[model samples]
Target: MTAVGAPQERAELAPLVTEPERPAPARRSPRRRGRMASWLLYAALAAVTVAFVYPFVWLVSASFKPRSEVFDNKLIPDTFTLDNYVQVWHEAPMALWLLNTVIVTVLATAAVTVSSAMVAWGFSYFRFRGRGPLFGLVLATMMLPGAVTMIPTYLIWNSLGQVGTLTPLWAQNLFGSAFYIFLLRQFFLGLPRELFEAARMDGANQWQVFTRIALPLTRPALVVTALFEFQAAWTDLMRPLIYLRDSSTFTIPRGLKAMLDQFGFGGEWHWEIVVTASVIATVPMIVLFFLGQRHFVEGIATTGSKG
Candidate 1:
């Protein structure tokens, strides 16, 4: 009787089998977490865009404001005037300056693109003796400061009787650049040797191969190079400052500097006109960027990448 009673007691004391507690429902679903992160990322990008773009917006608005209100930190001015634009036309030889800038920039940009591409082609495709050494020399050129070479170059151009004109500004591009050549060479190396071999097998000369095959296929890199050259030429002030003797031949930057010296140095500082001139000078660059943004982005993205 005692043994049977003990067995019954043991059975009663054993705990009931309990289902494991389901983990408390997740605070948020995976889909919800992903959506939250995506939203946060977009918000960050939007903020950065506004930060970069706000200054230009302010500049545009300030260009229309009165001189007294230029620094007011207000997007909308109390008074808007076209007097600034009117002044921009008459205050200096802006039209002449624009023409000079266009001529110099266009010529220099073309020279740089053509010369750099040719040099790059030689370095990439040719295997002559001293080719490696010559490339090394080209790279070494990049280390020499332009300022150090400026006086010597100017004297050389002066000796040639070309110092006072725009030729000195653009003529140097005929020699090509180490940086651009290196950039294009890498792209050329990535190109399939088979295409060039196939073209040569068909009796296409080097010139024909470069023009018909290489250039056409390397449009993205070429466009990028041209755009960079264009911007460099456009924004150059020092070259014009050194070489341009006549106000009539001054590039836009040099003319703008002259304007600042004439107007901003004294009692009657015409800030509005200065601002207006800046807007005129900057519009072309903005337009160019918008037009070639696709190509610009591609060139940067795939510059050194294999096909």
Candidate 2:
């Protein structure tokens, strides 16, 4: 090989010039990672909240809108009016229907709560033969389809000459609900047997023990049962439809059905009034749910945790 020139030799001997290596990216700390996860969770929750709440918000907005603009799909109304609300009261016996709903709900809720608590206390406190089998039978009743019993129930009610009034709507609740009994029984079982023994030592009767100790300790469960029954009675349309022949006896749901017939299907295109009434019907339930939300959640949590 030919000898290289001095400049070429010097150039070859020089170190190669290249870009410096970058430092590896800093690893995320646990706190940073947790913050990121929390933000993501918050964003997801906000999205779900909007998804669930937007329809109700739209309904409320529509209720305040003019008839032509009610279905315009706008969240904000260009023309706002309370005329729909005002006119709905005049068009229907809204006050009477509301009163009937309140009465029925209160009666049914009270009946079921007391009856179910009593049954639950018996199941929890009493140690007797066939107790398990008896509870199993009670639970089994829940499996029977409402449709299967509807005709028989109606016949029984008809035989008693109480089919037409609000009696059927609430009277059935005089017998403890299987599900409520089960829920409350779990709470009762979690109570220390020694507490009842102490109460007994103190000369407290079984009724006293239940009233003073069981009911107070298991208040959350009772509230849950009452709330559930209240919702059921408040929204019950089936019994009302089956028995209520007169418009004067109609509850909210039955009244709403009549209003739908009048406004939605009938010649009267007063859909705004229907929407307004819907808003009225829905607000009470929302208010109640918010009020009982803490007890509701606590009751469910405690029930699930208990035996």
Candidate 2 stretches greater than 4 Å from native: 1-40, 300-307
CA RMSD of each candidate after superposition: 14.1, 15.2
Strongest candidate by TM-score: 2
Q: Where does candidate 2 clash, by residue pair?
A: none
Give the alpha carbon lDDT tens digit for every residue of 1-307 in model 2. Answer: 1112336766554334222543333333466886898799999999999999999999999999999999999988999898898889999999999998998999999999999999999999999999999999998998898999899889998999987788888988988999899999988888899999999999999899999988999998899999888888999888999988789888899999999999988879888988889888889899989999987787667656753
- Per-residue C-alpha lDDT of model 1 across residues 75-178, encoded as one tens digit per residue: 78889887788878898999999999999999988999899999999999989999988988988887898888889889999999997799988989988877
The per-model lDDT (C-alpha) reads 0.84, 0.88
* Candidate 1 segments whose C-alpha is farther than 4 A from its true place: 1-40, 301-307
Q: Estimate each model's TM-score.
A: 0.84, 0.86
Cα misplacement distance, residue 240 of candidate 2 (Å): 1.6
What's the lDDT of the predicted structure labeled candidate 2? 0.88
Cα error of candidate 1 at position 243, Å? 1.2
RMSD of candidate 2 to the true fold? 15.2
